[model samples]
Target: MERISRKAAEARVLDLDGREHPLRSLWASRAAVLLFVRHFGCREQAVRLYREKGTIRALGAELVIIGNTVPCFARAFREDLAITTPIYVDPSMASYRLLDIRRLREALLSGGALKHKLSALCGGFRRVQTRLDRSQLGGVLVVRQDGAVVYRHLSEGADDHPAIEEILAALAPRTSDEAQASL
Candidate 1:
């Protein structure tokens, strides 16, 4: 339940259409579940987020996927996954760096990484990627309209992700005093 700093909240990101937006814009008017993926080719993360989109919306939160690649890859991913949820990219990775997201190159050979790939195959998702940053891990954040970050999860490795239930729980309404303190 750590709060996002002002600097991180103001970091810039680009939409699939290549328009820039401040990081807070995604949640400025509603609760947002920001999913930072390792890369657009990571179908396992894509499918997992896509599957949780409904439940997340049911809890009055919007799901946004942020990738660390060019807009074209994000666009193709949206089409491939048939994702209605909005997608954005951070080519400069300023948001990632400000949030202290990890970059672990050695994790590529970890057991969890292998498990994720196998899971993606079992789920009928496959993609061949090249020349993308594989070491940059991603995480999840639940932010409120007023800039209160109710939940934050920094990935330990490329295969790590937060539980959907934990994300949903973070969206539960907070008291005025609690919300005020976070700001």
Candidate 2:
């Protein structure tokens, strides 16, 4: 799994529509919010999650979801939830691996060092942490037209995360001129 450094060059990711959507293009053209959903097995869940959170209009950034689930399932789920954000299907787990997101809760559960009895007792705890972390998967990367990561929120665990408002603020142009200039 590759860690995306704050200084790394911007890369393009495919939309759920499978278009070669470039991050630079979005920065140059408009502000974008890349949402990484790990173990996104159902699109309905994705849609409900986003919709319930009001992610689309609240963030005012392009919604880009990356996950290791079937696109068809995601699509159906999104449709059921009435997600307006453009969804992207990362069937290959390329984005997940690139972002270094854990794909399975069980992977983290049994792999940790612990006594046999302790492991079993901690399994439930690990599962909860994994779910929480998965909910916060994908670092929210705010970039500029020149491909600079102006702001980044990389999580060390599941609970610590950047708020939607903070992400919107990061996506906001630094100056009025800068904001207008992009348009």
Candidate 3:
């Protein structure tokens, strides 16, 4: 896998409604949170994860799901929860590959390949496949307007991620007077 610099780019994204939107064109855009959900339909879990943690309001950032798993997520959240965040569908996996989150190759060569294939045949591949997609596990990345990744917590283990409060604290900006007072 090619190394992806731990930097955020000013890239264009499409919303669920197929409308083109840019990162720079958001309201009170203090920061942007990009959640890379694995599989083709895991939108529900992503929404639940965000809502349960109060991620949207706490972080005060635009929440974006950058993956092709919208079908799964949409079905899960649409039927139960109200998702306020925008979902971007990258069916080609371009974003996932660019982010170095594709684990299919590695999983195909690993000892768990057989199990994963069997699971796929039984319509349970996502559960098994997700265990192999290490890069997309979960992470909190703070990106400044200058396209710099100020902070990041990339974890390989499941459920090992930063809290919404922690992310908010990291992204909080100090006023010029506050900076001067501190000095």
Candidate 4:
């Protein structure tokens, strides 16, 4: 559990196309979902994210998935999943560390971890450790226009994640045109 300061404003990531840009550059809407996946193969959360991509867009937000792996892995995952959300590779895991996303060995005891593990196992997904840090963990941070992290959820294990409804609640537009009309 290392101290992680909010330095996302300065963090940069290499997009799948090998182009490097500041993490904030993806904030082309009301906010951006900075999702950090432990590795390239972990697809449960990714699948959910893929499904929720359009909902996120309707909130005036963009979804960016970042994985702690090489560019090839990132590209392959994006293509295989046909993910339209921007994906990035960070072999160095600079973004993960800076965001305080770390490993947890006691995940088995963490609430819902056992169930999640069981779910993964039943889903035909094996926990084959990767050459990279597979236990690195996952996280979600909602970044607003000012680079401020309005909401953050760090996983306790591979399966840990904020519920899709929870994320959408936090991301829903603060005001819609209908509401603005009243003002």
Worst 10 residues of 2 by lDDT: 125-134
Clash number for each model: 0, 5, 7, 0
lDDT of 1 by residue, 54-73 (tens): 88887788999999998988
TM-scores of all candidate predictions against the true structure: 0.88, 0.54, 0.54, 0.80
| Residue range 123-144, candidate 3, lDDT tens digits | 5324422212333444445555
lDDT of each: 0.84, 0.48, 0.48, 0.75
Cα RMSDs, all models:
2.7, 8.5, 7.4, 4.9
Quick one: RMSD of model 4?
A: 4.9
Please, what are the lDDT tens digits per residue for candidate 2 over residues 81-147?
Answer: 5666666555555555555554334333342323422543444322111112233344556554455
Clashing residue pairs found in predicted model 2? 16-87, 16-88, 43-74, 43-77, 44-77
Candidate with best TM-score: 1
**What stretches of model 2 exceed 4 Å from their correct place?**
1-14, 17-28, 41-60, 99-137, 175-183
> Comparing candidate 2 with candidate 4, which one achieves the higher lDDT?
4
Residue 72 displacement in candidate 2 (angstroms): 1.1
Ranking by lDDT: 1, 4, 2, 3
User: Which of the numbered candidates is closest to the native, going by highest lDDT?
Assistant: 1
Candidate 3 or 4, higher TM-score? 4
Name the lDDT value of residue 122 in candidate 2: 47
